[model samples]
Target: MIERRLKALANGPELRAHLLDPHTEAHLEAYAGNIEYGLGTVKMPVGVAGPLRVRGLFAGGDYPLPLATTEAALVASYHRGALAINDAGGCTSVLIDEAVSRAPGFAFPSVRDSGEFVAWVLGQLETMKAVTGQTTRHGELKGMKVTIEGNHVYLILQFHTGDASGQNMVTLAAEAICQFILENSPVTPDYHFVEANLSGDKKASAQSFTSVRGRKVTTEVVLSRQIVEQRLQTTPERMTDYWRFSAMGGVLSGTMGVHGHYANGLAALYIATGQDAACVAESAVGTTRLELTPDGGLYATLTLPNLMLGTVGGGTGLPSQQACLNMMGLAGTGKVRALAEVAGGLILAGELSIIAALSAGHFARAHRKLGRERGQEDTDTSTGQGDQP
Candidate 1:
């Protein structure tokens, strides 16, 4: 891998005139190997594509999972996606964990903007725990969050859902919470309640937003519609079938391909970081959407809602893994999303390279002539000459 660094001695257009040369690059060598803070748990693969290793003080448990090559491609593709955006236009992406979900055996009640109502709900939660003979440690507790948008209030319930995304748990929690608020709170009974699960979807959703960028950054892919139509031997009208199989819940013409990019990047990062790779199965199945722009370019957006990738938790505090994380310059609490975003960007770049290769007809020929096979004919000729002599 080649690493390059640039520093501006002074501001303005003439700054390049005063730029340092390779001699200056030599003086900065000592600062090169210093590991970035908080990224001590990412083990890079040896070859161009190989197993990533992560070392850390991890609890003895089931945290290992085998990832497929296709999955790896998706991760690589998202990385490329990031590069594309960086080149085309400076864009920003904000990640929010708005999943108001829970575990199956837990329940939480929502409440309105009244101190008295909150007191009542707490009492009810305690009573419910007693009636069900359940404990929070045993995964029978409900989690809830409430946000204010102007005079309107929205409540979100989060459950420590086991295995599954815990959509049911969140739904139940939100409903119960809403019921509690309407009945006990001092606010009016006419407040609106929406049951839509918005966070984990592939397509963007609107709400009382906690975070957002100035411009929404979306990943778009353009595959010749004619080629797609030829691949499946179907008309454009049947593109919906392609969308269903490619990404569930996608509309006509196809589903979103962006999530495929996320899946690819995270798997590689997971393998490198010694994280629970299996979590990626659920992580990748999330929101994938495909649509078309007015100019006929296909757009894909994949938003993974439950990507529990961490930089400081689990195995991130180790040796070689730390070095790899240092190479990427990623660390800290809120930086996981930033890392994810970067990984997403890189995967997109990789995918674009892959797609372009296949489309350009060089994919097969590039690998066909490598290794001992390239010298097979020469070896055979040498053997024949020896026998004749």
Candidate 2:
């Protein structure tokens, strides 16, 4: 039936042969709730970086990072960073906060109506908790923030979702809360939507830096002057100088967060670990700071305010994603917080290596040597000289 519909759309036999072969079609039933009109899977190249060492509240010891990407030089750069960090006795990572939110918008007939609705909603916190409890076994209504914009009121409902990314969990809970408000509230909304776009779902926003969307994590490492020079092929002072310049560039460019390439490492890890890869939009927003320590070492930190991920739900149950999670010993229950810490560490490693490469004038050279296709000359003049390290 699926093939017939594709054929009607003028898809050629050869295309179907590659996309819907017997091996691929056999797994269609398993993807029931995850997809509709399932075509086939695209095989992405996966690589492992680390034995990156980390010490955190939930995560401890060294763990291999499973990254799925086709981008060249990415895994190698992160691997180099991980090695440097390990030599420095690893990084300290911490999961600072965790929460998932859904902002439901209510349109009122007048500003007075919206004002009354906000007051009523504030008084119904306990009632809203009860409504959310009926929706999910693992989700809990933590708190909510009411934003009034003229006659429209946005209720940002927050939830504590255990061991899951909680996007769907919070959405369901928010819907129940909205339903309760519609039934019991004194002021009737002209109309209401479950999501008001104020929640910063799967997008980069200023709110990501100020509030926790899913998980907020901070990871830091201190590298001695000798270690920075030997392992990163750059001096601490040079790296710090380049970091200051980069920070200024970020500010000038109006970047939400100041970091080199958080998305590169995050997107790969998310894909490999069965996370909502789209969440990288906000998950990658963070600050990376590099400074010279009093003892002549380099003090570096990466603080990510939005790290939406899970260990037991969504894509985590899928075959390949589960394998990746298991490789890090982060599969199943009691591992989501640890996973967030590891994610922070992973981003820190990438940031360190990239900054070192740029500071040492090896950025373009490394790319030309490892990032380009075989037999391809370095023709991209945009990045300046591709000097050898």
Candidate 3:
């Protein structure tokens, strides 16, 4: 029974020795600690364990681009940000709701020769029976962007990339477009590094000089009532004090790493999703802020600089990852963005929970209990009294 629980609780070998009955009980104890510390269920009311509002906010925050991570107190620090403000008063919280990316780029380059390129592209479209003339009119191509640099043009083809991440579909489209351009256009066309898998790793060779054509993919959020009263646990004044404390702790420290609230949670989620755990270093940095609205509500927002996540590719397409994706209702179109959003929401919630604990002066106590358990086990071993009572 303990082994089964341990398998459910942890994925790999680092959890090897610790995968015992006591540790599993300890994990449950931590949840109990939450109750003891006055952290209520997320479903509860204001000053509860959940967020006050279920909305989102994204002002003074940039796009959640693909980026790196830090080893410092990142997730914890983000939690600190939440705590600092929550202790002062109630505040609004914008949880990341969702994110997705589309690929295949454009059928042709946009440039000085754009007229010729478009004509050529149209010719190719005419040749392909798969080209749905009506589909183009729909919003499927709404986020499409194009750019040119000399002979090289980049296409950032984006559709609503539902749940499956659409990476392969985009790549196929891009490859077809590149073929058409090379055959029809007079200009020598090149492509970016392609490894069948667009890992976006720096090491791949180029088929052409690929230029970034699309906008930095992103999703926005706004927080109002649901975020207040619940997530932060305090009113406006307390929120201000929280930010003051955060300012002293290098809120903008790139080297310092991810905000504290996201660290453990993201690590666990990423592991569950089969994402490269090391990449959490990049996907974690974000812009965190707290503001007061005219309506007297405290608002908090966090925009991750990079969220290198995929829903259908890599591990996401693998059996376990696919199962997890399915469990989240993110198995198909538009679901990847939904996954990102849920991740954001959970991360924000974690921030609130961590902050609430710290402000109420229980974080240290929780850690102390964990340490005491370890210490007692050590004493038992030394005295040859290792048997469990």
lDDT at residue 382 of model 1 (Cα atoms): 16
Q: Write the per-residue lDDT of candidate 3 for residues 1-389, one digit (tens) a residue.
A: 33454456545344545433343344443334223422112211111111212232422211121111232223332333333333343233332332222333222244556545544554443343233223322223323344544544444443433333333444554455455556766644445421222333212112112221111222223334334344433455455456557655654652332244555656656655645565554455554455666766655555553454656544565444455556555554444544565456546645544544455454554444433444433112221111121
The TM-score obtained by model 2 is 0.93
Top TM-score model: 2
Residues 82-187, model 1: lDDT tens digits = 3333333322233444233321111123333433344444556554433223322212334444444334443344444332223334345445555545565444
lDDT-best of 1 and 3: 3
lDDT of 2 by residue, 1-389 (tens): 77776677666576678777776678776556676766666678898888799999999999999999988778778888898898899999999999999999999999999999888889999989999999999989999999999999999888999999999999989988889999999999999999999999999999887789999999999999988887788899999899999999999999998999999999999999999899999898999999999999999998999999999788888777889999999999899999999999999989998998898888878787767656753322232212211
Rank the candidate models, highest lDDT first.
2, 3, 1
From the highest TM-score down, the ranking of the candidates is: 2, 3, 1
Question: In angstroms, how far off is 145's CA in candidate 2?
Answer: 0.7
**Model 3 lDDT at residue 313:** 49
The better-scoring model by lDDT among 2 and 3 is: 2
